[model samples]
Target: MSQIKGSSADQPTNAPLGALHDIRVLDLTQALAGPFCTSLLGDQGAQIIKVEPARGDMIRYAGPFAKDAKTHDFGNVFQNANRNKRSLVLDLKSAEGQEVLLRLVAQADVLVENFSSGVMERLGLDYERLSAINPKLVYTSIRGFGDKVGGESPYGHWPAFDIVAQAMGGLMSITGKNENSNVRVGSGVGDTVPGLYAAFGTMAALLEAKSSGRGQYVDVAMVDAVLAVSEVVVNTYDATGVSPQPMGNELRGFAPFNTVAVKDGEVALGAPHNPQWSKLCTIMGREELITDPRFDSDLKRWNNKTEVYEIVEAWTSQYTRAELTEILGGKVPLGPVLNAEAIFADPHFAARQMLCEVENPRTGRPARITGPAVKLGRTPASIRHRAPLLGEHSREVLLEAGLSDAEINRLVEVGATTINEEQVLIKESAVR
Candidate 1:
């Protein structure tokens, strides 16, 4: 533990709303999934103390760096995932650091980690050990696979990245154009989906802990979480002996639920069931086509999906996406295929506050970032603080741990901690 500097007289204020104001969280996770989960909790006023190894979280090196090109300065990916939290650099392998972690566990309401199966136990900080220190501490573990019961596979020990999980969890099977061309999802759905489940599980455990006056362990496996989202494909294979293939822009069980080419761009429309198909035909001035034996029912239209989509495209290609949207939008379900620029400029996104501007301390400019997906009316999510510089709050966090100034100086002198002096110097130089 390090000590406090600057104004030791001024105490740090709590989070604005303080929804989870008193709830202390020890975040021992890294990379995308687990960080994202804790970030969400931090947004709602959880006192998240991010315990980073001496080398820092791997995301610090994952780039989109500032003009100065400092590797450890907040990279875009790192900033996006880790906001509204305090960070402490500690070498968990060291006895002193492990003792500090144990102290934190004793005072914490939750301990979240995404280490491999046995790392916690190897550290002698597993649920069994920590529960003795604080019986009400919720221990949440995120892993690549479930270690309980017969669910543990031989690959449990092997490390996994987002791409590996996507491939192994069946997301790639139905994500591309055809059987030969399988595509992994563009985003880290495999990693993030599991994180989402883990966060939910942690919250549930907290609620339970309140009632039972005991803490429980939460196990969230990326493979299982990704597989849960891939249930449609699983059910399709189970119900019918046929495995679903990648069908680019086409809905698996519904007809006319695909993309159509317009004169200017493309639009997606969904005739979810039979009645919507009839409504679509009527709106297109093709009432006769609705009565045709080949397109009368949902099954019939599905059987002749190619021809049905071709007919729709013929009509669509004569008009721009905007024109078609005006003519048929919300009548039978329709939306234009908006690109990134268009999405940023969209009125709906603006109205919903889906995009927002946060001040970037490094750039000294407003950086546009995505707003919170989950909207709560009472306690709305916000970006109160900019992403921190490397070890920005080292002194403040150590002060919270009740360290003295001389002790912090000794730790820094001994090479156990660091600060972004270079970044501060750069900023000062720029101002001059």
Candidate 2:
């Protein structure tokens, strides 16, 4: 067997004093939400075993494949969400595979799955059964709608892509130019936010388990999570008895917090607070507007937002982003509407260590990827490894699970397990 070269055990350890370092996560998720949650855990130094189906996670094939790549590139999207974890492939439908999974569960601290509500129960790996093996395991389930609460709805069993959740959760209603033209946000916030909440819930449960000596189930619905983020829309309807319409590049309640044209490109400014508004006037060389009744108070300015924006834009359009940034540097919240290439070249991103480069052993090239969003000073998150090739650590992971070499080989022969070189090569060759 060819050794996998960059196991976490062999990496230079800056073991983050992260809160979840002691936790172990068994990730049986694919695509966006569930993997994103586990990625957060992995970033915080938790050990994550990403268990993929026999054919592998679908995201591996969802591309923008790498430049001139032959196979599914594991695209930037997958790489971004799946770093700092190990991969283990197993056929969950096989009896032997189920046995191996149960063995892994015996030692796991958490099990995260985003399959439809009852799938885990059908596979005999549901929270009730797994908790029997390890009573302290935190079992987290991410679904379109939670089984315990909303599973009987007609949409519950229907597969929900990100857009479906966005539309149903009120995000689409408030997203675009107007009421008739509801648009989805560019990113997968519907999936991503629920995953984030699920991760938070998992950690909270883990902390509780420490004292109670028992684990609990965490159920996060994508629609519920999206609704949580749509508080503004819900609150507006409740308070005014009016459904809010989409106002592109404009905030529903705030004035001068929207996009304004600069000399070259556009910048977004949020001088919502009184002091920030005053400071923004000073930055725009229009200090007199601070006392002008039409633009003085937040309420008055909100009523006349179009005129207020016109005044602000008249001043902003004359200056470059640098000039605007220098004027509003610490006075008001401001940022340029940067594109992808511009963001990659931006200094603030580099200074904050928001971007990092990891060497891809297969490509023998450095792959630049985004680092974890939150920065913890004491136990700062660090990238330990590039995203794994399919089944990259299968043998080593099963070995750690106490499986012998012959057992691993038997499973491999029976189409119950796979390794990186075999599976990824077929994928890579097909694309090439």
Candidate 3:
């Protein structure tokens, strides 16, 4: 285990009230799914005490690091999933560490974890045990397959990852150009989607617990979340008696609802409805196609989509993405398949504050990460703090858990926990 610094001392004290300002979450998750869930809560102004092993979250070492990096505490994946949280290092396998967690749970609004199915039970820190300590603690878990509490699956015990979830959940089947290509999504939707669902479930349970005076276990399955979001695949197969396959960039049963090759790059254009299709034809200088029998209605155009795509591409290929956008941006459902560079340079990112600039406390330098997506008029979510250093908040959090300074030092000395003398903020990298 490496020594790193952490604390909430450096954060803005005057941050606006958030929806979850009164909530306190004990985050016992790592990597993507679990961290993502707690991070969402943290962003919404919940105080997240991120409990980790002495060494910190494993994903902190997985990175394209910043220059002169001293500790494996700051990395791209870790930062993105861990913002607005405090770190508390404890060896959960230790009796002392377990005791500390129980104390924290007594006052916490929620506890969330993503360990393999039986790990919690093995550690004697399962929801049953935790809830005994704090009956109103909303315990949530994110697993590859559904957990027993949520409804057991045959593969519940098996460990799974993003690709595994996507493959099993029918997302890969309908993601690519054809049935042969089982394409994984470009983003971490397999994990993050489950995290989003888990967060929602936790909030719902917390809401109910407020009035009912009891908390329940909330389970989220990665495969289940993916399947829920891929309703098109399920509905298409159920209604048509045939599995859906990828149609490249085309939307099923819609004409001109595909990616077209432009002069410089590909642009997505979806003008399948009558008025929009007619307007698209006018823009393309193909007004005759609007009246042509084979390309008249959306169904007719879809039936002869090959010809329609060819004609659209012929017109689009003469214009650059910029040119096409200028002519038909707001008028049609259109966008260029923008790369990261284009996204960064886009005015929309600036106007909407989609890119947030956060300073690295360790380096005293700045980096940009994706900002909060949800925009509430009164209590919007925002990333107010950076990721914590490993074990950075051990003493502070332990003190809050009703431990004395001497007791905290004794736990640190005995290896039950770890804390640094000088708080070094472990600023993690963004997913660039």
Candidate 4:
């Protein structure tokens, strides 16, 4: 719908080899979960062709975009979620559009979507149809609940989001300060955790397809993903027959494994084991506590954690987080409660190459995004390209799909496809 100014991909011509170097993925999902899933694959060098609708991925408008952004087509959310992927715009509701997708699916190694359960069936592009065309196609889906391909759930048709997943997945039940003050996670783990699982499942399915010569469906439920990570809740309830409650900033069984007050903010410390607890007492000038009966072991200290935290806080409150970091940083598993500002300024992130500085292709201005977390020694993942403009790659992608220039023009002439002409120019000038 909008003027495009991007490319099929601004991919590095001689990029390093990646784990998924030979794979091609059709990214048909939007918002967080689906985009995030493909993003992981993209980082690992998968050829991710992000299939967006005529209006784009919806996130194209969800922006706190750069001040110098030349077009509204580039959104920051797109930068993080759809990086390393090319954007292709097609009106899937159109018969022509569905034909184009079927063409791509014929060669695509994988296809991922997050539409409500039956939307793919309605489009006649569901896995059954696509796999009939290409038996080696790894079909993947991310839903609020598990899809029928993965398993059965009564709530397949129910619409859900991050908050719903958190509420239903048992994460919020044990994530807050107390029984009545349950809070959602600071980030969208509900979407992202499921996305990560989908990525992993896709990889596993792809691996199996390599050996069996047939691709299978990989289904991921946001609720199940959340529960998978909340092992403490299930184990505690099963073993003790008692429900777990949020314990504020402290873990219940590990004394001093909690945030303590500091002069400017909170600093987390983990000296729960008796030896480290004794060392902490020495640092606090409370050496007598080494022999104290109430804190002689981890269990004893946990039993009296209230008193233990009070004593630790008395010492910590006198110092800033930085001061405490200098005093006890490497001696124990400790960290200051870092906000975004702190994280941005942290040198450790720089040293680890975690704060990646990527330029906005549309704006020709720079911004930072967190780099890939899963590092490999031989086949490292990277954030090599920025997000594409809406339907920025229509012509190039269509050409690659074996359509003639005339056919591409005909599609463009119809309401089925929208093309942006400027991305190729910008990409050649800026990147090439």
Candidate 5:
């Protein structure tokens, strides 16, 4: 309902681009999941006003900051998750801070938070109150378990992290070397996947709000997101009335649908179809196995997959990862398991623009980060700048929001903002 007024940033080169460039979001999130959600939106060119506490986000101080960074706030974890966002540090526990947040909410198209259940209500900034100010605001929440506004699961009060999501969401049960051992996913997919869902859900709600002239709550639960990704496990259990256990790296019904050993490392290869299987057999110089009774059909080969893997590995084991790639890269579904160093070195990543470079704002040192995954030919998503320092854009953001210099100064004096007179003057041009 409010007009977009200011978008000038400290660095003129880092102009926002993409379809969502005109949209504004108030990011009241911290740590991984919530920040990840907003970061995705920011990557697509949303103006993300990241509202942090006076002390700043937990991640800002919880570093391993960038090498020789003037500010300890430039934590690599924070940098990786918070690119393209502008920071505003405010004391939201105070009345003045609440008033400021409400003002921003009135102008923002969306507001996202990931605090546990009842935290918003306790802070007196719940959706019911904020929506009354801006009926078109798309308020979204990311939580471990959903709240009353959603399905009202009894476990809403439970403290959860990535491990809880993996365990409770059935991911761990179906992911290990054996039935007796369950392993959490290697990364924080539990947080990231749910955050991704939240970002999508927010987009859906925003699209609907455009036509309906009203917004609704987008509730995304981490556990639910994990379960959604483990679709195969659910489908198998539902279809056969049998729970699938961790069957190692092999696919239960598909022969040669797993990684095989190479001389230096492992490469995942799949040849579960007849044509591909025949090609693989020929390549291995074991042409007779293609029509042998035990390995005649894909299903028969699956029934004897232990032998299938042995035969495949026997051929693969002699070659290094690079050698196997040269021999079998195009013939079958193949992926070489890569480490960080390999990813950085791989030409494929560079060609695809998957590895992006940006400068650390405090240090002016160039750093590489993963780039925006969604490629748009017309209006591409750009990494305009690195993540902000704590309260880096507070004065500029408020000025852009139409607050006068005097009013901003008063708030700073009242301890509601972490801005000084010098900081207030530093980015005044950002509003111009």
Candidate 6:
């Protein structure tokens, strides 16, 4: 490997004191799943050093950019996943870059990536090699099938995306209106769910390593994650020897536990329990159903769901979602299907702080984004900063890593690195 160089100045101070504050993460992943995994870590106060190629993470060019961004770093997807991490542009193809990575690995507490199984081995930076430099390093890999760290799957060598994971893992099998037309989930849970699992797995490995004075490879397959999440299908199939089919928005084994149409829109309604079902019958002015043999018990109602659904829908469809909400919101377990606008305007979201504002470099104004889901009374998760510009912290990060200014300049001069701090611009008047 070639000689390395870089310099660092004073680091920022606005970061929150999170649970993982002492941890250092070298993020070698890109795209949704891997980036999201690192982002979760970043949220919990890990010092995430995102290693990018000279051109930057490919997701940076994804569009739907902010209006004021002439040179857009990324759009909604990238922004959502890459926040609270510093960027370091290093071309791994170069020998110097590989050496630089190895040096970083020596000091990092955790290193995470989502490349295919053999990419790390090809780069000569696999867990075995990196752990040799730092025995306590918690190295995690998130992939479609999985790496050989635990045990290799039959499809370990195959490439996969969120849709592929969803399909192969059986999520799509029970996602649509019927079995004939299986649908992919709208969100990228197939990717991010695996990311979440990897985050937990990484933390667990880190904890064990602390006690044992040894690090272990933590691997999570996207397919496996989805399969774990959709275990109902597997359990149902295994118990009865019948493959599960999509029941649309309804619980196949529970009556009235489904999305019902209203005059204006749809609302999810679930009154499967006896008390709730009895109340629902009274509310619908169909109290006779309380004694009807076909609808008396939960099992009978489920068995005769077609008749029960028709009766419920007939009453629900007569009212608008708002009117239905007024009548049944507290009495029955129901919620209107909310769109983005509705969510933004909802008091519940505001009260919970589910949506939060951050300073946007493009407009130099506040931009609203989703807030962290987990809230710790102490050491709360927070968004310290927006996503970084390409190579935005390359020099600074290298400096913090103890490289001299001269070496930093040489790396930039040799076309091996680049830095741009001006990419993040906030107006002086804007509040943090």
Candidate 2 on 1-432: residue-level lDDT in tens?
A: 101234333455444546567788999999999989999998888888999987788998787656745566467677778887888999998988999999999999999999986788799888889999999999998888766843456667878878988998998998888788899999899889998999999989998998999999898889889999998679999999998888887787689888889998888889876898888888667899999988889899899988988898998888899998888777789987888898888888888777777645435456677787888877877777667777888998999999999999999999888876654453466468
Q: Residue 269 lDDT in model 2?
A: 88
- What lDDT is reached at residue 336 by model 5? 95
lDDT of 1 by residue, 319-359 (tens): 98888989997787899888889998888888776776654
Off by over 4 Å in 2: 1-10, 14-17, 149-154, 421-432
Worst 10 residues of 5 by lDDT: 1-10
Tens digits of lDDT, candidate 6, 1-432: 111111111124654579999999999998889999999998888999999988788788877688877667667678778877888998787777888888898889999998888988898888889999999999999999998876879999999999999999999999999888899999999899999999999999999988999988998999999999998688999999998999898775788899988998789999997899999999888888899988888899899998888989988999998999999989989999988999999998887777766555556555676777888888988777777767878987898877899988888887778877564333223324
Worst lDDT run of 10 residues, candidate 6, spans 1-10
- The C-alpha TM-scores of every prediction are 0.89, 0.92, 0.93, 0.93, 0.92, 0.92
* Candidate 4 lDDT: 0.86
Name the TM-score of candidate 3.
0.93
Candidate 6, backbone clash total:
4
Q: lDDT of each structure?
A: 0.77, 0.82, 0.85, 0.86, 0.85, 0.84
Ranking by lDDT: 4, 3, 5, 6, 2, 1
Clashing pairs in 2: 70-431, 70-432
* Clash tally, candidates in order: 1, 2, 1, 2, 0, 4
Model 5: residue 296 alpha-carbon error in angstroms: 3.5
Please write out the lDDT profile of model 5 over residues 300-394, one tens digit for every residue: 99999889888889899999988888988888778898889989888888877787666565555566777888878877777777777678788
Which regions in candidate 4 have their CA more than 4 angstroms from the true location?
1-8, 68-71, 285-288, 425-432
Report the lDDT of model 1 for residue 295: 86
| Model 3: worst 10 consecutive residues (lDDT sum) | 1-10
Which residue pairs clash in candidate 6? 5-407, 6-408, 7-399, 8-399
Instruction: Provide the RMSD of all predictions against the true structure, rounded to 1 decimal.
Output: 4.7, 4.2, 4.4, 3.5, 4.5, 5.3
